[model samples]
Target: MPEASPWDGISVPAHTDYTVRQVPGPTAVPCFWGRDRSGACLFILDLDGDHTDQYRKNTTTINGIDVDLRGEAGRQRLVLTLEEQIDRDLFGGLCSTLIAALGNASDAPTSLAVALAHIRRWKTFLSGRAAHHLTPEQVRGLFAELVFLEEMLDRGGTAPAAVQAWLGPEMSHQDFIFGNTAVEIKSLSGTERSTVRISSEDQLESLNDNLFLRVYRLSDLPDAAGARSLNDQVVRIQARLAAPEQIESFDRKLVLHRYAPLPEYDAPLLVVSAVRTFRVAGDNFPRLARSGLPEGVARVAYDIRIEALAPFECDNDLVFGGGNG
Candidate 1:
């Protein structure tokens, strides 16, 4: 527990939110998600208001334990900044606990591992629902917002284009169509912050039509993962496989589009199957496409380079955790 704000004393910082009396025992901090605060930590993770009065009257429990934001009946009423700082400290402690428990630097306990797995599962729920986009600076903010979100829940979301990993203008059915197995490419950039949504009938149609190609950040060398192109990725993967010590850096572009690398037959190879309607499996849920496949369905495989899937411009706000406070 933390000591309440000392407003009764002297100095005060402008951005401070509130103060609360220190309780005897320690508490676990909840993971934080969405906030209009951008990268600022001046406010509580999910709290939206500055109702000092509320702190003065209410008793609430974070997780399950009761917390009296207000100082005991006679003590100085709690301030908003006090509560904000306490929550911040809690969030930090939780991060360290999660990382260490996960064996970031050393071996952690099994219980912690299990707890982290659960958190990951829960985070997936949040990532699936994030309709909003994040900028690079916002994405890598020191708070590790997404990482925190993951610990809080138990699942995740994509950081599309952080490295300029966009849907390239080239796709090939020949690569995706493999004796009953389909593979579609789903890539991301090395430094992008926005998440790409894999929804919609057509999008789902493509995913259903072929196995998804989810190429993300992978590095075999010190600075190699920072490379930004399919060519770079290929080169790095090869170097690592051939001679790991020979490579210096490994920064490559992310790709998750449909593809196949067949060396036996290179002459006008088929990439796409004739099936117009198909099923779609994704990083999240699975579904079947409603519309027909692309034109000229006779080819077993078609080299349909990605022209453009489409842009998402939904007007709705992405409410995190169903906006639960």
Candidate 2:
């Protein structure tokens, strides 16, 4: 049988805004689980004192959920209400996970911080879900980044340092940065045209640091013997990480990238057929730099043919040499 949910047996009372039962766990702060008048799920954190000044200013909208501070003064409660459109099972998982996070906190402020961080993670996860799965394009892109990340780890760096170098999830200009060197990653189907799209003017602009673009040509073949899925790569990386802190950091970055391991990511297996590295410095390289763009022209995106980058092509060692090259 499946495990029981915290929301089980919780019911909303008639004529009341909510009918709540204290969350059953050893949490640092008092928490409750309930249902609103319309039977929507709710998670409330009862604050010991008025924390409105700290929390109120940070309030922002989250999809499929509502966050608010209710009551006044000594009775103020931080409420999280699940919208009717959201899946109950998912919300239940979120509530339980959040409570577990709060259990590690030692005070109300810490609990509030944990709560906000948890909700922000969910916000990223929910916004990226399409039928509860990432799109094929997203999968391919993420797979490429993982491939590069795994290579970095294999180069003998500490797991924490290598994972921390991944800045793609944070929307940084470069996908991976190590000291004075930066690398941008791209992916494309092996059967498609040999071209990569540069999303912005700053992507190839190395400034004073060295920069390289790494492209992975992947074949999506599920029946092949050497095929692997996105989940396969994620688990492979996880197995190599022995430190709990590094593992947690890696998992958090994955969530921030709008990825959740679902059955769908288990198939339509992908295999990297070839990888090409290109040096992005020198005036001969083909790219649009921010310094060269018109005064108001920003968010520029353009494509660069792989063949045109031949002159600027370099070996993988020069790019992934741990910033020494």
Model 1 reaches what TM-score against the true structure?
0.20
Task: Residues 1-325, candidate 1: write the lDDT tens digits.
Answer: 6653222233233454332222222222222221222222211211222434534332223331122233343332211222343345444343333322222111112222222332332232223332233333222221121122222223232222111112231233212332243433332333433243343334344433333332222222333333222222222232221111111111111112111111111221111111111123444334224444356442232222222221211111111222111
Q: Best lDDT goes to which candidate?
A: 2
- Report every candidate's CA lDDT: 0.26, 0.80
Off by over 4 Å in 2: 1-132, 322-325
- RMSD each, Å: 21.4, 7.4
TM-scores for the candidates: 0.20, 0.63
- Cα RMSD for predicted model 1: 21.4
What's the C-alpha lDDT at position 259 in model 1? 14
